[model samples]
Structures are given as C-alpha cells and as structure tokens.
Target: MKPSLYIATALMLASTSGFAQRPPAISSPDVHADNTVTFKYYSRTAQKVSLSGEFLSGNHAMTKDTSGIWSITVGPVKPDIYPYAFVVDSVPVADPNNTYIFANERFKRSIVDIPGNTPLVHALQKVPHGKVSYRLYPSKTLGTTRQLLVYTPPGFNPAGKTKYPVLYLIHGGSDTEETWTKVGRANFIADNLIAQKKAVPMIIVMPYGNVRPAPMPDFTKEVMQDIIPFIEANYPVLADPQHRAVAGFSVGGGQTLNIGLTNTSKFAYVSSYAPYTQTEEFQKNFGATYAPNAEQVNKQLKLFTISVGTDDFLYESVKQNIAMFTAKGIRLRSDIVPGGHTWMNCKQYLATTLQGIFK
Candidate 1:
C-alpha cells in the first residue's frame, strides 16, 4: 500500500471507531421547575439500577432504556440540597453524569440542588460572599501536616483592624473538611446570614477531624494544640476563648464534647448537632464515674447547646445525654426539631448555630 492510501484507510477506520464508541450525552439530577429532579445513569451492562437519596424515604427503582441508560424522576422534593446515588447491581456509586459529589471518606454519592420559590439559606444568592481558603497546618499531635478550610467573611482583611471571632466547625464521621462547604453549604449559609446581618462577620475553620490509623483521641489534642494556634497566628482573629466557638456533627459531634467540654478555657460556645456519642471517648469523658465541675463549666461556657432532630436515630441517646447533663447541674440548651441525621438537617442546624453563637 502507498503512503497516501494507508493514511486514508487509517483515518476512515478511526472515524468509524470514534463514532461507534461515543456515548450519548445525558444529564443526571435535572431539577425541574416543579422541584422534581430526574436522575440518569448510563450503564449498558448493569443488571439492576436503583435511586437512593435523602429526598426519598426509600430506594426508588430506575428504568433502563434501549440506549443502556437508567433513569428515575423523583420528587417535587422539598427544596434542598440532597445526596443521591445509583446502586448498580449491588454496589452504590455516584452518578457519572453529575459532577457535584458528597465530600466524604466512605460514601460515593452525587448531590442535587433543588431550588425553592423562596430563597433557601443554603442557596447561592446574590449576596456578598465569603472566601473559603484551603490551608495546611502542622499537627504536632498527629506527627504530620494536615489540611483545613477557613471561611473568611465578606470584607475580611488580614491587615485590617477589625479582628473577627472564630468558629471551629467539624464535619460528621467519614466526612472530610470539605463536606462542611461542599455538601453543607456552610460558606453560602454564612454569606447569606452575614449579608442579612443575622450572623456577625466571623471566621470559620473546618478542620479534618478523622485521625485514622491512630487513636481518635489524638484529634482533640490536634485541635487544641495545633489548629487553634495556627489560626490565631496566621489570621486576624480574636485570640481569647470568649470569642471562640467549637461545634460538630455526628462523630465530630462526639469530638466537640471531648474537645470543648474538657477545655472550657478554649471554647466559649459549644454546639453539637445530631451527635453520635456512642464512642469510647464519650464513655471515658462523661462516663458513670466521671463527675464534672458543673458550676465552673457553666461559668466558663457562654453557650452550651445540643441540637438534634426528632426522627434522628440517636434521638434516644441524645435525650439521655441531655437528661444526664441536666442531672449533673450543667446548664444546657437543647433544640429539638423535626428531621433525621441528614445533611439537609445539618444545614438548618448550622444556620441556627450561626445566629445563636457570638451574639
């Protein structure tokens, strides 16, 4: 074959292969005007596909098309951000069509944002936005360098005379620091709250709370010794405990109790949301034999609150914890709302916390 003939043959074959291999374009999590969302997944070989999300009470089946696409249209779902996944065969996987993902160590789920007619707190509005800075800090307790996210409110200036208060926020178990921003929409929530003057201009530090392959207790030390000091040294933040707050959800909620309660001199405001307190740390810290100096703790803490949903799995235990705290003469504020241990509830909890804290 001559050179021109060979090149022409190869080009024709390549064009044919490319056309044959290309998949049709499709959209997952197409939010409709009515608030219903249609989710799609392209899989030719899968035996089964189902949609699972916080929006639905149970798993909904997906219908497969002749084009090897599986899809399900779900809900005039309550306007909120939700994590959903397609379970192919038996394994749960994130929607390949959707780029927004739930930031966690364990779950591979995609996010769908359904907007309300009225603006939701987590919705991205035309408000003055804060900046989320990814920073690396040295963690002496963990013997390694760690990453954290800092949210500086609108008009934040490191060189400015206005020093802001700090909120050390922690995510749930298996959730990375980014979960607070990506899934929970903490920055947008803060931006909206601050714009409306509902929340004071402050700095929020979301640290990686999972210290695995090492004892979980080390995270408390890391927060106390490393993260706080790094924030104070690097940012124009209020240094005293009176201007500092600590809060978390789920496993990090348990961590909040460990870190904040133990060192009342560090956090003036401590809030735990749907806290999963059934841990060795919780037992060790607030165990049967452990008795806290309630008066001293009350005096040191400007605010001590625990918020949990009525339908949460940990509701009974949370109620028990509340009762125990009350019995021990510890002044506590409990916000019992209706929902479960989902990120949807997490946003509401954070919004309330923002308004309540640093007041």
Candidate 2:
C-alpha cells in the first residue's frame, strides 16, 4: 500500500474506533425494590469519588468498576427528599446525569426524592393544585424592587365574595423567594390538605427576607408595610388579624418571632421552625421589650408556636427563648421532634401548623 492509502486507512480507523463510540450507560440513583438506591458517576480521570448526603453516615467512598465508573448503592434510604453531591478528589459537584437539584449559595447538590409508594407531602397527586404567582413590587422600606411568591389555594377567586385567610410563609437563609414553593413543595402541601379538608384554603405569601447594608434588614417593616399591603390590595384575602398568620424557617423563623410577636394585633397565628437566634442579643433587646407586653400578645395571639428539631444546633437557643417567654406567662406550644435544621423537619412543622391554624 502506498503512503496515501495508509493515511486514508488511519483516518477511517480514527473516525470509526473508540473515539466515536458511546460510553457505557450510567444509571444514577437507581431505585430498588428494598428501598435501596445505586448512584453512579462516570469519571475516567478522577483519583477518588465519595458520596456525601443526608442519606449516609457522612462521606462514603464509592467503588470503582473496571470501566473507571464510580458507584455506590446505599441501602434503604428513608422515604423523603434528600440533597446529595459527589466529591471527586475533594471538589464537590452535582451529578452531571441528574437534573433535579436543590439551591444553596455555597454548595451545589443533586436532589433525590425517595417517594413512598403512596404520594408523600411533597409529592404530586390527582388533587386540585393551587396557583403560584411571582409578584414584583417596589419596597418603600428598602427603596428597591422586590419579589414575592404567593400561593393561592384551590378555588381561590379574588372576584368572588369568598375571602380566605393568609399565611405569610418565609424561606430559610441562602434561599430565594421561590424556595418555599419550588423546593419545599408548599403549593402541593396546600392542595393536598385542602382536598382532604384538613386545612382551610388560604393564601401563602413568601417574600425575599434579606436586605442590603446590615447584618439583617428590617424585614418586619418591609413585610408589614409593603408585602402585606400588596397582597391585601390585589388578592381576595381577609386582611385582618384574625385571618392572618406568619411562619418561617431558619433566619425567617427568627424574623417570624420578632415581627409576629411584636405585632400581635396584626398576626393571629405565629410559628417558627428551627429558628436561628443569638440568645444573648435576643435577651438583651427583644426579650426585655416583649416580656413586658407578654399579656397583650398572649391575649391577641390565637396560636403561638415554636417547632425545632432535637438535634438542631439552634435547639438549645430556641429552648432558651421558649423558657424566657414561658417565664413571661406567654402560652407557648412546642414541637421538639427528631432531626436537624433541615427541610425534612420544616415540612413536618409546616404541616402541623397548617392543621391547627385558623380553625
């Protein structure tokens, strides 16, 4: 064969050989019958890969096959939504093959939901789903345009005569206004609850809880002034204390206590889930002021509740707040359940609060 023939043969082989072939199939988070799941990642160059998530007992090393694909099948993960990531050689990254992801400012994670055979609280069902509206309005308090997410329950019609109560649900730190309905499944929960007649149809208001130029913004001021007024003016809501509730998780939880408790005349039902508070600061400022007004708050408050996980870092601090309020002769309801400051427990607390509120 001449040199030209040889060159043509080499080019044909390069085009048709392994370089053009498709790699092996990767089945990430492959669910099994016994409630186990197999997570797989294809990485030919990585020296190590470890799986880290709420499902495992810390970082678990993945086993590599002959094809250099790292994998791990963890047994019997509980039926819930979990966020996981792969730390390939110490750098964390979401599963490239997985599209479901959770939001976080510092870390990226791939979300997996091990749904029960039946529909869970976060799972979608045949029930009538509510409407989620992303509303934008100018915040006079902050001097900026802000976004808020609102959930209107099934059959909610502003033009009709029926007016529903409102729940101002706040999101956690590192989450945007969309977190509650998008990740926490707030609309689905509301839909399911209303369908079963377990919860009254209501409007859920989710606001952007953060502001610039401070350790924190005057969220209480913004919500009380801007967000509430916007909702009342536009939506078919019973814009009164008896029909208004406030609840939140994490930083939003702290805001809930600070704003809702102080304005007892405005919010009838007030609750917090895994609230983060600096005990010393709370005692120095809020505690002293609110302790004196405990009677009025207790009188006007239809439901005053705090729910925290036993294993949460803020558990003891939350207990301290509760103790202070208890000493002030304020009626307080507590849900000290298992888990930590996580969405798993947030959902439980929200479910419980919805059942008992506005009844």
Candidate 3:
C-alpha cells in the first residue's frame, strides 16, 4: 500500500476501462460524383442484414462479403429526404452510421440527407413555405380535449377574406395528429404542390384519429361524431361538401373509406392510401357486406381514389376493395404504385391525389 504502488494501480484501471468502453465502430460509404449514395455496415457476428425502406424494391437484403461487411447501393433515388432503417437479423434497427433522424409522435426515424438536386429523387426548391400551427380543440365525442395540427398556406391569415378548401389528413395506428405533418411531411408536400401550381391552395387539418382507451373505433362514429363538427366550426374553410376531402394512410386509409362511403354527403373527395379494412371487425362495424349492386347505396361521391404500393402487406386487400367497389357500380380510381407500406408511397400519392382533387 505504498504511494507509488497505489498510483500505478489507479493508472492501470483507467487504461483498461477506457479501452473497453470504446464506441461501436461504424462505416458509411461515400457519395459518388454521380449522386448515388451507398451504405455499408459491419456486423461480423450478425447472421443476416437487410435494408428496408421506401427507396428499395422489396427490403433489399444486403450482400455480405468475405470481409464481413454488408453493403447496398440505393439510388438513383429522387432528390428528397428519405427516412429509413436497417433490419439486422429480423430486428428493426436504426442506421448507426447516420446522424439525422425525423421525429414522430411515437418514435424517432433515422434519415439520410439526399439532396433534391440529384436526378434520382425530388429536389427541394426555393418555393413558398407553408405554416403549420399546432392547436388544441375540445372534442365532445371523446369526452375530452384533443390536439389538432393545421397547415395554412403561405398567405393564410385569419383576417384575410379568402375561404380555402380543407383536406383532413389522418395518420395510421400508433400515430398521433403530428404523424402526417412531422413524419409524412404533409406540410412540405402541400407547399411544393401549391408552389408548382399542381394543387390548389388549401388548408390541411391533421387531427388525432385514434380513439383512446378503446380499440380502434368505427370511423363512422369517430369522424361523424368528432372530427367533422370541429373542422366546420373552428376554421375559415368552406363548409360545403365539394370543398372538403378526407384522406389517410394505413388504418387511417380504412377510416377514409369507411367514413367517406357511409357519409358520402360529408366528403366529396376520398382517398385511401394502403387502407386496411378486411377484418371481421371492419365488416361488422361498417356493415361492409359483399354486395354486387353498385346502386345499393346512394353515391354522392365526386372522387373516390384508392392507392396502394405494389409491395404493401395490404396490397391484396386493397385490390379486392377496388374490385368490390367496381362490382357494386362504384366508379373509383385505383392506383398501384411501385413501393411498399411506408411513408414514401403515401407521400407521393398525397401529392398526386391532392392535385387532381377539387379540380
């Protein structure tokens, strides 16, 4: 226990701990001059690795070389920010090599900064940016106050004398009112579309679609009893059915169809992106029987557009919905894009569908 011996022991402990605590090693590929960005991960102990995202065709499985690194070249992707994650051995994980992430209500998404100037993805331009205002509204149906996000176009002002069409954009399950604006970049889509003159200047209302403390409620009750009245009373929007549209992704998509069809007089335009409504609960709740008669229900719908990614898990169900609607004499537009069940597909659909709506 001499002074010199004690000092030597302390130094040895510090050195050992420092070496053991080194951070995990991460390696990322360089962006080529041609604008294509490659990504690589090293997991010598991992049995499998794959990249699952909007950019790839079908969750492209990485090729593990003899050097123990898994790699893939994903591009020419359009010039836009894409959120993606790596799945290692059946487990969903974020990219350790990337620093950017997009936040949602429930979780954080790892993002890769893909410049829009690149020929592969949609590039960001110097367009008029829209304003997203977060507000709280009282909901009688839920018996409580709820959050609502309103996206106003560039010149939106309460004192202004302009009445804008409103699009009610709903998020999927496990998401809140912020999902569409935050993760889906609904405001950005609207901004770009309006700037390019592709879509009319409109106000987008994103409300929390999930009925808390209960299983997903019937869209008929939730939309009819809650969302509709709130929009009509609170905003400076057209109250007419022709100026109103309802759209959603995944579970929200199902809600669009369930609520839009049953209450056709409320929403003139309806769009469902990768909607899921084939369960027995959906049938029982919506009274969605397989009817071959198109004239069975009164059709006051102006436009009923259904879009799904080709690789979506609900692809078949969406196709069946299209066919079922057709057999019933319901004339609708069905779009099958080249992607899967992710925000990328939904974003593209939102851009296009909003352009064709209220025209």
Candidate 4:
C-alpha cells in the first residue's frame, strides 16, 4: 500500500477530526500501525527539501518526486512526542499538516505526537504527582527581582511530617526557569520515574541561571548565593549537603560545575548536559579556569555526570572535558547519545540522569 494511505488511516484512527478536515497537500509517504510516521511536503519552487530532526537516524535528505514533493518515512518511531521540521531549499519550515508545536530557543517547530504505548516514548506512567509554584524572588547579586519556578515532589508540604532532598536544575542561556518544566518536561519525567520506582522522590528547584545584559560578570555567583539561599529558606527542603544535587543544560551546565564545585559543601551531586568544557571567550570574560587537577575537585563530588549527543556542535569540547576529567582520576559517567544539541537530546539526558540520581 502507498505510504500516504497508511498515514491517512493512522490519522483517522488517532484524531477525532476524521477525514472531514482538508487533507495535507503533501501527505506522508508512509505510516505504520506500529506507530511509525512519515512526512511529506510539496514545494515546487524549491530545488531540494530535506528532513532534519533528533528522532531520525541522521539529518537525512528526503527524496524529491518529479512533482516536487519531498518525503521520507521514519519509524516505527518511539511513542513519545518528537519535534521536527523540514529544510526546503535549505530553509527550515514547519510541517503544514501538523499543529503540534514546541519552542526551541527562539524558534518554533512542528511536533508529531506518537502513541505513548510505543517503546520509543519513555515510560511516564502515574508517578507520584508534584506541584509547581511560580514566584518572584529578589536577587542581591543581580540587584533585581527575577521570576522562577519550583517543583516540589508528591509529598511536598510544609505541614507534612518529612523533609525532602532537592535537585537544583538550571536552564541554559536564552532560556528561563520554565524551560525545565515546560519544554524539558522535567516534572513529567520525575513523576514517571518516581512512579516506576526508578528514582528517589525529591524536590526539583528550577531557577533562572542567566544574568541578563551584556558583559554580565559572575553569573554563577548569582545562582549560588542568591537563588539557592532563597529556595532553601522558602521551601520545605533538606538543607544538608547529602540531599542536594545541581544540574543544567549547555551554558547552565557550565554554571552547575562552576557553582556546585566551588561550593562543594552545598551540592553533592552534579550533572552537566551538553556543557561547554572550556570556552576561551567565557574564560576571558568571566576569569574562570578549570582546575589544574580535577582529582582535587572530583574527590568532593558524590556523582558527576556529563552527557552530549554525537552530533552536537559542542561534542568536541565535551569530549575534551571528559578526557581531562578522566585523566585526573575523576570517574564521570559520560554519555554520547545519537542526536544533535536539540531539546530532544536534553530531555533524554534528563530522564536517564535522574534515574540514577539519589539511588
């Protein structure tokens, strides 16, 4: 059977709109009952069109039919939702057929929803639910008030009888505290993991890590001194070092190492997802330097993990950091997943890393 026919059938089964809506001018080349999905786009004016996404095997170029429609079939894709866009004539464009969308940095892309039952989707079943709170806090370091989001685990309540461990999750540059919960879906991942008995129930504190305005100095200090103290004081969380973990993505990952390592007594576990190991510009601007001997720093860390995708633009620097840390007798779990530096890879890292945390 033709691929478009399969997609049409699958869409009919999944969507309530039925076949009443106008069919996409360019239909998917293939769809599977097993949850595989194919996408097609017609751009007669374009010389070439390619599909690029974290879900595909690679940024594979789609075959263009004589009619000028570009298409590719990928799957059976995992059940979890996937973000993707098409490159037409080297220009990125969202799928006209799908309405699902997600924010990536400043850009937005169309998303395809796969069935949750599919193995590709991470198992996020009925985990102990968590509560998310949004608030404004004064930052003495930044000399301004900043908005932040906090996620307390299922049993989180000041009136409750118990205190919970805390995970300080920082966002990357160009993102805010909402990034972890909104785009990264950290709460959902945590809920699912806890329910699956994969991780210990803990509170997650997501704070805005960026120090806005150009030439901002000492961003890490602001996070450590200002944000950490505010959260610890305001929330019903364990204040001890053993119960504290700090992690982040990209620039935020660098901040995690800088803030967590320098304040070893405050955080016991540290994880960096797609972190920049050593940027000369950063070093020059912030006067930050990697320790000559990481063993000295590693000894104080309980768990240190760094992960980056194979296709990530930062892959080289991440590798260098891993090598430096490894040479210094720092036992770090380094993961090189199969995607680029997209949010998809970051989400996967979050799920995998949190599973091993507080174990």
Clashing pairs in 2: none
Model 1 lDDT tens row, 1-359: 56675467546656795454434567777999999888888889898899999888778899999999898887789899988888898989998778899999887899999987999999899999999999998898888888999999999999999999999999999999999999999999999999999999999999999987532468888888899999999999988988999999988888888788888888899999988888765677765322557888899899999999999999999999988889989898999999998899999999999998888
Per-residue lDDT tens digits for candidate 2, residues 1-359, read 56675467557756785675334556688878777888998888899999998877789899899998899989798888787899999899998778777755656788887886877877888999889998899899988898898899887777999998999998887777877876688888888888989999999998888654331337888888898999899998888899999999998888788778878999899998988777454445575657789789889999999999998999998998788789889998988999988887877888888888899
Off by over 4 Å in 4: 1-33, 38-52, 56-75, 86-100, 116-124, 213-217, 281-296
- Candidate number with the higher TM-score (1 or 2): 1
Which candidate order results from sorting by TM-score in descending order?
A: 1, 2, 3, 4
* lDDT tens digits by residue: candidate 4, 1-359: 56687578557756765444343355443446777778898766787788876577557777878776678877777665567888887788888766555644676667665654543324344556878898799988878998888887777777776878888887877777877776677888788777777888888888877665521247677767787788778877778877889888898887776766666667778898998646554555323343554665566678889999998999998898788667756678898889788777777988887887776
Error of 4 at 134 (Å): 2.3
State which candidate has the highest TM-score: 1
Q: Name model 3 segments beyond 4 Å from true.
A: 1-33, 38-80, 86-108, 118-123, 212-219, 286-299
- Could you estimate the TM-score for every candidate? 0.92, 0.89, 0.76, 0.74
Candidate 3 residue-wise lDDT, 1-359, digit = tens: 56685467546655785453322344564455555777777777788898876565578788888877888887777655567777889787777667655555555557665665433213345788888988877777767788889899988876678888989888887777877865677888788888888899999988888765433354457667776677667668887888989899898888777777766777889899999887666666555532433453336678889999898999999998888778667888898888888777777888877798888
